[model samples]
Structure formats: structure tokens, C-alpha cells
Target: MSAIRFDDVWKEYGDHIVLERVTMEVEPRAFIALVGPSGCGKTTLLRMLLGEEQPSRGQILVDGKPLLAEPDADRGVVFQRYSVFPHLTVLQNVMLGREFRDAKFSARLFGAARRAAAADEAMKLLAEVGLAGQESKYPSALSGGMQQRLALAQAIMRGPKILLLDEPFGALDPGIRADIHVLMKRLWNETHLTVVMVTHDLSEAFGLATRVIALERSRNRPEERERYGATVSRDLEIFPRRRAELRSSVQPAPAGTTRSGKEHQPGRPGALVLKEQP
Candidate 1:
């Protein structure tokens, strides 16, 4: 089943049309990069998927069900700006999401024991993002790259199934950006999350995404600009290794196959073979 489906979706604000007839199915565990010129509504599409805005026509489905009107823990988002709370330390920032969720349905606060466990998880998450020893530092104390890392950790702490990124690495230095790219891939591979990122950098899009989606307006003349909206102009699969891995994981394994995708030898318990004979 598709993790997300945008069905003939259209979005308009009074006389302004942002998206028209945008339809696509994003497979589960897919890393999708949405690229387009400035003001072409790439971020608008991301916002709609995040449930911050609704389509003027048609519908959007998540896991084959209509989306809720507002954002939920099932989705996490990071924007161009570092969104960490400046007043809170790194550890506190990451733990804040869980605290809110725990206190959401119940007014009671977590006891000392529960708080300690949550803190430990937050520490581990910060470590994963390469901010291990900076937990005690405030956002102001860190560099721009470190601040962004904190924002990522905060977004990921809730264990969202979908992660939305809007020009997340755009402001970083070239060297830092490359490092973050590697880290981003590691995070995606290690987690079960599907990612949708909007970036203006084509190189970044091509390097990080398993598939690249380009959005463009069909008519760009001054006379008919507002009358038309952007749609998917190009879809490209640029990651051969990732594509092969995804296909293998989703397809059913042959009978008597071992966990390594090799066949188990017949009449020999726990014996494995490279492949089954024809």
C-alpha cells in the first residue's frame, strides 16, 4: 500500500492557484525530493501533506485513509530555520516533544522515574544526530549546523512515520552540508520513516533522494500566470542501489529461503545455500 497518495489535488487561495491536478503515490520508506523554482509551490505541497493546509479540491490519503485536518505525531517537519527552542538546552529540547505527548491526554506530569527514562532516550537520540556531548548546551551556544542537528533530533524524538524537510541544509557550509547528507542517509536507512524534502539545490536533491520530483507551472507567461498552477513535471529514480534494496525488501521471499535471501538446503537442518537449483 502507498504510504501517501495525493489524488487530483488542487490548492487555491482566493485568486491565487498554487497547485493543480497534482496526483502522486509515495511508496512507504521512500525518500522523495521535491524540487522546483522559487514560488512554484513546492513548500506549499509539503505544507498540505503535513496537514497545515487543505486542498481546495480532491483529497489526500495517508495509509489509505483521509488525513486529519491538523498535524499529528505521525508526521515530523523541519524548516530552513533552526527551530529548536533557544531557551531550552539541547537535551531539554529533544525531550520536550515526548513530555507534551505524555501530558496531552492526561494533566498529570511524569514522576521522577519516568522522567529519567525519557531523558535517557533523548540522550541517545541526540547522540545519533552527532550532538552527544552538547546536551547541556543551549541552542545559542552551538553553531548553525549544531542547531540544525538539535532541531532534527527534536523532530525525530516522537518517532514519526513521515519526516518533512524544507530546505534543511541550504544554509550550511559546503563541507558541513556534505556531512549532513551522509548523516541524513544513515538516519533514513536506520529508521522506518518516509521522507519528503523540498530543496532548491538540484545537486542536493539528486544526491539525497531515492527519487526526484520536479514541480513546474505549465504556463509561465505574465498574462496567464495566476490562472495556471504547478504540477509534477519530472519524476526520476536516481538511486539504483536503494531502488534494488526496496524492491527486494517488499517482494515476497521464495519458500525455504534463509534470512540472508539465500535458499535453505533440503534435508539438511539449518543448512544454507547460495541459491536453489532450478
Candidate 2:
């Protein structure tokens, strides 16, 4: 069954349309990586899923229910920037989600015993994400990779069914990015959470995603700008492979073609091309 579904969704900004007639279904526990050139509405689509932006037309459904508002714990997002609280310790940052969920008046009123329990759980999560020994450090003190891990811990602590990532590894160095890729794969395996990631790197998308989606502008001319917007030009499922093997085995998706060396077919479940909005 589809964990998430988009039906003829359109997003516009006054005269400029961002997304048009995007339609797709994300199966439960699917790892999706959305890849496209800059300004292809990749991030816009992720933002809509996060409820940070609303579509101008059509519906976004989660578990068969329409999404009508801002993000809740059901969907957690991690951006390219390390989104940890600067002043708060790593433990506190990870505990914030639980505290907010359990708090009555305010999270600050959460008692010592409750806070301790939350901390214990947070510690386990920190350990899982390779941040166990550094929980006392502030965000500034941690390395870039460590901070991202902390961010991941914070998001995972919420136990979100769907995780949305917008270039979560974009700022890291190659070695660090690779390390994070492994960490992320391990986490995904353990949690079985459905993930949608926006990335510019096609190799990254191919290596990590069970599915790859590419968006592109329907029309490029200045006169046609207002008449067209980005749509899902290509959507294809990727078979699973070890990260080590993925890079060597998979060739980059050629322009106007998918990683599997096939042109997109809208009728196919594995490679779909969405129609433009009216």
C-alpha cells in the first residue's frame, strides 16, 4: 500500500508556477531520492510533504488521509544545515521532541524523573547515530558530521513514520558524506521508515534510494514560463545494492533518460512521467 500519495498536485507562486500536475505514490518503507537540476521544484515538493508549503491545486495524502496543515510528528525533516539548538546540549536537543509531546503547560515543566527517562532514551538514540560520547557537547563544539548525526538523532527521536531530508549531506566533505551514507543506510534498515530525500547528486540518489525521481521544467521560454512549471519528468525504482557496489555498478542517469538507461514511461510504476498542469 502507498504510505504517501500525490494526486495531480500543483504549486504556484502568483505568476510563477513551481510544481504542476505531479502525481506519484510512495510505498511504505520506500527510500526515495528526488534528483533534478536547480529550480526543478525538488525542494518545493519536499517542503510540501513537510507541510511547510501548500499545493495550489490537488491533494497530498498520507495513509489515505488528506494533508491540511503544517508538519507534525508524523513527518520529520532534516535540512542541509545542522538544525540543532545551539545553546542546548545534544541530549537536550534529542529530548526536545519527547518533552513537547509529553508536556502539559510547557516542556519546561517536565519533571526531573520524566526528563531523566527521556534522556536515557535519547542516549540510546545518540549511540545509534554515533553521537553517544558527545551528547554533552554543544552544537558548535561538534564537527560538521557529528552535528548532522545529532540532527538525525533529533529527528529519529520523534519516531516519525516518514522522514523528509533536503540535501542533508550537501555541506559535508566526501569522506564525511560517505560515512553519513552508511549511517543513514543502517538507520533505515533498522527503522523501516519511509524516507524522501532531495539531492542534487545523482550518484547519491542512485546509491541510497530504492526509488529515484527527477523533476524538470515543462517549458523554458520566458513567454512560456507562466504557462508551465516543473513536473516529474522521470520516476524509477532502483534495486538495492551495497554502497560499495552501487558506485561502481550504476552509471549516471543520462540526460532525458533514467539510471536504468530507459526513457520514462508514465504508465509504468517504475518509471513514470507526470503530466503538466492545465
Candidate 3:
């Protein structure tokens, strides 16, 4: 389990401030969605959570441990673009992280048995992400949605404590994006993996998050910085725990299945069931 806490964090690139005095806490196994307009530091917050960037001021802690010096296995990240290697098969690409992180072998003599086990694990994750029977395919052969699924499977193959997604489904069609959302929700329920996703889509945020955080720019002038600072909105909305029926209602049925079990229903938009909570 991982609990994340950001205390008065400030992030800057040279002289440009990305995040200012941003503070929040993410409970263990909590699905937190960071939503905002462009250039509001949502991705920067994800980077800090992933330990890829350090805050210019204040601190962030994960599971009671500081984030700046944590190891890679503690956090898994999936970006909007496909991060798979074109040269390798899907199984091979998924196993790369485990092979480097845990294997003790020379490239000249990588053990067959070890690699096979790793492949099996990767295959299982691929199946979970709806990529079954595609393990032998190369990255170039898959659709954009399938590639993102592969990337996600690769990220979670090692079971990181925290999963960071930065607009991972942004490039996919609406139908595919909705399918990914269902997959993500199922994964979260099954594994209870703490997730922090940065998304520009308000509907996606509202659909997937246990709590949503909205970030905005400060409007305080320099003279009034201390006296009358502009307060950015940080609205938090927790959705009610979704039952299987609720999830099933919105879940896209298996490929080739139809409303009548014979003919497929084309252009059926996936429903997103979001039960709002305080």
C-alpha cells in the first residue's frame, strides 16, 4: 500500500513556475484524478509522484517515505504515447522491466527458463488488459488503443505500489477510450493498486476517480501575495463505491457479442456510470 502526501509543493522550470504551493494527500489504494486545463502542472505533479522530478520547494512523501530518492519499482508510469519498443514482441517488451530490475544474467546467456516465466507473467497482464492472443505481435501491428494497453500491462507487470497515468488514452477513439476506462476500473478493484492519473478530460476524471482535484492558476498580485493571495480551487469529489452491476452496465461487451447475440450493435457508445459523492 502507498499513501502519498504533498506538503506545500512548488515546481519550477528555470524561472517559470509549474505548480505553486500545491498540497494534497492520496490514501493507499485511492484512485485520484488530477484534472485541469493545459499548462496547469498536472503532468508535473505526476512526474513528482513518480520520482522523475523534484519539487523546488516543500516535499512529497509516499508510504511515509520521501519520493525524491525512491527506486523505480515503487512507481509505475504510463504516458499518453506508446512507450513500447518497436523491435520487440509484446511479450518481450513487457518483460524488459522485470528482466532489468530483477534478473542476474549476462546478455549473452540469459536463461531460457527465467525468460519464459517472465513472458508468462507478461502474457497474463496482457490478457487482463484485453490483449489476449496478441503477445506474439509487434508494437507496430497493434492499434493505438492496443498499444496503450500493452504499455499499461508492461508498467504493472512488476506490481508497483503506485500507478501514474498521464493522459494514457488521449489518442484513442472514444469507443476504445471507454473500454480502457472499464479495464482500468476493473484492474483497480481487483488489485487495489493506488492510482494517480493526470487527465484533461473532465468526463474521464469524473468517471474514473475516487477523488478529483482541480488545479488553477493563482491571480494574486506580487504586492498582495501575502495579504490577499488568490485561492485556486481544489475541489475534491469522491464517487460512491461501484457495484458489479453498475460496472457491468457500463462495460463494453466482449468483441463480436451483440445485443441479440447474433448481430453486432455498431457504434454503441459505452456508458460511464458515475455516482457522485460528497
Candidate 4:
């Protein structure tokens, strides 16, 4: 099962603290939305979870193990900017997942038949993500939402346990953003994948996340920020699933029932702060 935890995590850049004493846990299959003002360390948390950044003093755990210092198949990421390679066609980009499943040398040893099988699967995934006929087009030729879909297709090809999104829909237009949201909701429903998203849109965060985490820089003095850092100002549980539903339900936790159930006692303003140490 997929799980994540941050134990007193702190991040610093040459004494400029970005995150401080951030302690949290992400249960398996959790849809977590992090909302905060820009430069409040939301993206930093996502990067840390993705293994692109290291915590200065604390530990990050995945499935109860210390997180590695590099990206891995256990976690997949989609950024605000399109991450697809401009030089590669959509199919090629999606096919990279298959090629990466094995070692470079081992992939070279695969017979043409085996390679073709992998290509066929990639094509299916392309179709699944609505890029069926656009596989031959380069990423530069696709629209913003299509590019996002391509990126998502590539990530899904890996079957990662946890998916991380950093402002994934921030740059898209309203209509495109809504479409992407629907697509993402469907994928999450089908995959039961753990998700942690960083978004500035409060409406999107509340509408999409089972848990809403808000971070803010809490320095009283102007110079304190250089030494101090952003902290979890608010951690609200929007909706928690019941134990019975979690055990029996397989589909994505329904839209409003993300954190529904008798196990979670609702708190102020319909937000249950599971842990308040932040």
C-alpha cells in the first residue's frame, strides 16, 4: 500500500528557510490538496516528496521507509508547465515508460516481438488519455490541455503508487481546466492512486481534495523570514471516508465523500484537523 509521512521536516537554502517543522501524514489513496499563497513552500513540499529536494533536519517516509534522494517509479509527478519532450512525438513520449521498465541494456536485448507488445500497450494508453490519433504529433503541436493529458498518460504508463501534481492545472484556461479535472477524477477513481497536489485555487482545492492543507509564512519580523520559514497554518479534513466504505468501496471515494464516515469526527467548519502539529 502507498503511504507518506513528514516528520518535523525542514528545508533551508543557505539559511533561507523554506519549510519549517512540517509534520504530516498522507494515508494510502488520499487525495490531498495543498493551498497557500505563492512562495509559502507548497511546491517545496511536493518537490521534497518527489525526491527532488532533501529535508534539512527531518525525515520523509514512503511506506514507512526513508525517502530516497532521487525520483522513482513509486511516485510520479506532473508539473504546471508541460513536461513532455518537444523533440519526441506523443507516442514516443508515452512509450518511454515501457523502455524504462527494464534496464537500458536489458531493453536492448528484447526481441522485436516484445518491443512491439510494449508499443501496443502504449498505444492503448494513448487512446485511454484521448490522444488516440494524435500519437504521431509532437508535444509542441498539441494544445495545453492535450499536452497535460500526454504528460498524464506518460505518468500512468509507469503505474506509480503516488502521484504528485504541482499547479498542474494552473496555466490552463477555464474550460480546459474543467476538462482536465474531469479526466483526473476519472483516473483517480480507476487507479485509487495516492495524490498530493499543490494549487493556489481554493475552490479547486476544496472541490478536489479529501484533505486541505494550508501553509503560510509566519514571521512577525521582516527579517525573520530569511531565518524562519513557512509553516502549516491550517490543516483541515474536508471529508473522510467511513471504514466500511473504505473496506468495501473500490471506486474513487465519491466526490463529497472523500473523508466521509463515522471514524472521522467532523471539526470546526466541516474540517477535521487530523494532526495539528504543523
Candidate 5:
């Protein structure tokens, strides 16, 4: 289990102010959905948590320790664009998940025994994500929903302590979204990982998350918008908080050594994680 805290966080880009005084605490294995307007720094907050960007005036802590400057094995992410390599086959894409955490700086092919082990793991995840028959295909050949599934498979392959999703399912159609939502629920229920998601879909947020957080500027006049950055306007906790039940639903997969025996330092955005997107 892992917990996240944002203490007096602020972010700025030159003359533009995005978020201000954003403070919140996330309990272990909680599913949080962040919703806000387009330029309100919803994704910016996520990037900061992912270590892609830093808080201008405050800090983010994961399981008590401060977040690193770069993403580590403890955090994994899934982007809306399906953060998978278009060039690699579906199987190779999943293999990168294991290799990325192992290599960190660079993830490439492994030796025979290691490659076989990784392949087995990747295939299991692929089957779980319903991509068993598509292993030999490329990302370009799969539909949008299938690609996103592949992205999730890679992210889960790493066994992240915190899973950060940035509009991960916004691109899929209604039918596909519904199906993926079920898949998402299954993943969360089975893994019991702390997940934070950014989305514009309230129904989606309400449907899956244990908590829903809204951020927007109180004063949005043309002149006052920049002066007043967005803050958490509302935070709604889903009824019947089942976190304790979730912990017992499935055994937490050990990613790495736990800190203080209670906090798990499990594992990065499930980013074929080390290449430029085409």
C-alpha cells in the first residue's frame, strides 16, 4: 500500500499560473479521479506527481519520502495516447515493461533465459488484457481500445506502487469505454494499487473512483483567470469506502523492498517506456 500527499503545491510557467495552493492527502490503495477545465493544470499536477515537472512552491510526497526528480520504479503511468511503441510488436511492447524497470536508463533485449522469463510474464499480462492473439501485431494495426489495453498491460507489467493515468480512456468510443471501464475496475480490484486519474468524464470518474476531486478557478473573468489559478473546488468521497476490503481482495504484488514494512515501494508510467512516440 502507498499514500500520496500534496502540501501547499503551486505551479507556474513564466507569466502563466496554473495551479495554486493545491493540498490533499491520498490514502493507501485509493482510486482518485481529478477533473477540471482544459488549462487548469490537471495534467500538470499529474506530471509533477510523475516527476516530469516539479511543484513551483511546494512538494509531493509518496509514502512519506519526497518524490524524485525523475520517475522511478515505484510509479507507473498510462497516457491517453496509449503510451506504447508503434514500431514494436505487441509482445515486444510488453517485454519492455520488465526491461524498463530493470534497466531504468535504457531498456533493450535480454539474454536467452531472461528473455524467456520476460516473455512468459508478458504473455500472461497480454492474455489478461485480452490481447493474447494479437501478440504479433503492431500498435498501428490495433484499434484505439486495443492499444490502450496494451498500454495498461505494460503499465501493470511493472507492478507500480502508484499508477498515474492521464486521460487514459478519453479517446475510445462509448461502447469501448464501457468495456475498458470494466477492465479498469478488474485491474484495480485485483491489484489494490493506488491509482490517480485525470479525466473530463464525470460519469467515468463517478463510476470507477473511490474519490472524485474537482479543480477550477473561483474567478474566471478574462482578467482574473491568470491571477487566480485553479484549486480544489470540491472533493467527493464515494460512499461505502471499501479500502480495507480491497487490500484483502488480492495479495499485493511485491515490486521491491517495502519501506518500514508497511509502505510498499513497489515500482514508472507503464512509459514502451524509453522511446520517442511516432
Candidate 6:
């Protein structure tokens, strides 16, 4: 069964059209990235998937059902900005979602003991994300990269089947961005969760996606032209089974830490290398 499907989807903002007649299907357990220039409706499409906006035309389905207004256990999302609460420790932040949304009534009803169990689960998730020992740290105390990892951990704590990432690493430095890339690869491999990411970075899309879908403006034929001129066309190109060799050289090292336990130089030997591969 398709994990997500979009049929002739279109979005408009009053007189302006954002997306036009977009159709696509995301297979179960697949990693797909949507790439396009700014204002090409990438974020708009993501918002549609998240049910933040209803399509002016067409339909979208998640696991063959209509999308929900609020995210559920079946879907998890990570955004560019860190969503961790500054006042809450990492473990508490990660546990909050599941504690409130998933646990049985008995657990939800009980105050202290249930929270303790939730904390345990949160710790396990933190360990999975390589943040085991930092559970007590506040979001403010962690580095930007670490905070992103914590956000990812929190999103996955509910064991969602589909993961949506909207430029989750966009703000990081090149070195830290690479590290997160490696970490994300590891997490995806281990969990096999279907992932759909919206990225402005072509290298990121090429490196991580099993398939890359590029959105472009569509052009109308003479027969279809209207008096106001042919509507702005939007098109998509899909590349499947992207080459792994293109990605092997881009594996990122940990942020702020070097093999010699010293600060890393910007032009260090192992800094990110972008190589073209088919």
C-alpha cells in the first residue's frame, strides 16, 4: 500500500497559485526528498501533508486515509528550528509527546510513576540518538546540532511510521550538517521509517533520498492558453535509486569535536567534500 499519495493537488493564495495539478505517491518504507527553489511550493506541499492547509483541489491520503489536522502516532515531523523546550531537560522534552498522547489511561492517569516510566523511555530514545549521557541537559545548554538531534529523538519517540523533515539541518554549519547527515542515515537504516524531506540543498537531497523529486514550473500548450496567458506551469522530475557512491564521501563528522579531541579548523583535512556521482 502507498504510504502517502497526492492526486492532482493544487494550492492557491487568493489570486496567486502556488502549486498546480501535482500528483505523486510515496511508497511505504521509501526515502523521498522534494527539492525546488524557494517559493516553488515545497513548504506549502509539506504543510498540506501536515494538514496545516487544505488543498484547493485534489486529495491527499496517509496510509490510504485522509490526513489529520494534528500529527498522530502514525506521523512524526522535525522542522528546521529546534522545537525543544528551553526550560525542560532533553529527556523530559522527548517524553512529553508520548506521555500525553500514547500511554494507556492508567499510565496517563497516574502522575508520578507514569512520568518515571516515560522518563525511562525517553532515556532509551536519547541513547538511540547518541545523546544518552546528556539527558539532564537543557536545550539551551546543548549545541545547535545536538538540539536538532534531540528534536529528532522526540519526534521518533512515538514510533511513527512516517517521518517528515523540513530542512531540519538547514541552519547548521557545513561540518555539523554533515555529521547530522550521517546520523540521519544511521537512524533511517535502523528504523526503516518512510521519510519525506523538503530540502533546498541539492547535495542533501542527492545524498539521502532513494528518490529525488524536483518541482519546476509547467508551461501550457497553445490550445490550453488562456487570455491572461498560459497559467504558470509546475512540473516534477523523479530520479530513482540514487547512487550511494555520491554519498559515501559526504559522511559528516561529529560537531565541535575532532579525532584528536581538539577544536576543528574550518579548512581541516576531513571537511565536507562534494563529489558528483551518477
lDDT of 6: 0.70
lDDT of 1 by residue, 1-278 (tens): 12688889999999988899998767666688999999999999999988999999999988679988899889998888858888889998999888888887763346998889999999988888999999998999998888888888898888898999989989999999998888888777666678999998999998988778999999999978898999988877663525313233234434333134444355533223344436
Compose the digit string of candidate 6's lDDT tens values, residues 35-84: 87676778788888877788888899875688886656677788988577
lDDT by residue (193-248, candidate 3, tens digit) is 67889898889988988778887777546654333321235656453643222234
Q: Kindly report the root-mean-square deviation of model 6 from the true structure over all alpha carbons.
A: 12.0
What tens digits encode model 5's per-residue C-alpha lDDT throughout 1-278? 57788989999888678999998877667789999889888999999999999899989988678999898768889999949999899999888868875765767655788888889989988998889999999999999999999999988888888999999999999999999999888888778578999999999998998888999988899999777889998887766543433446466544432212233222311100111213
Each prediction's TM-score against the native? 0.85, 0.85, 0.79, 0.85, 0.86, 0.75
**Candidate 2 lDDT tens digits, 21-48:** 9988766566889998898889999999
Off by over 4 Å in 1: 105-109, 239-278
Checking candidate 6 for backbone clashes, the offending pairs are: 178-252, 217-233, 218-233, 218-234
Task: Report clashes for each candidate as comma-separated counts.
Answer: 0, 0, 0, 6, 8, 4
For 1-278, candidate 4 gives per-residue lDDT tens digits of 26688899999999789999998877666788899888899999999999998999899998679998999988888998857878889988887777877647654327788778877988988887788999899999999999999999999888898999999989899998888887887677667588899999898888777778999988848868688899888887764531112433344554432343213444543233233322
- Candidate lDDT (C-alpha), each: 0.81, 0.81, 0.72, 0.80, 0.82, 0.70
What's the distance in Å from true for residue 228, model 2?
A: 0.7
Give the 10-residue window scoring lowest on summed lDDT in candidate 6.
268-277
Name the best candidate (by TM-score).
5
Instruction: Indicate the residue-level lDDT of 172 in model 5.
Output: 91
Give me the candidate number with maximum lDDT: 5
Q: Indicate the worst ten consecutive residues by lDDT in candidate 2.
A: 241-250
Distance from true position, residue 86, model 5, in Å? 1.0
Q: Which TM-score value belongs to model 2?
A: 0.85
**What's the residue-level lDDT of 66 in candidate 5?**
92
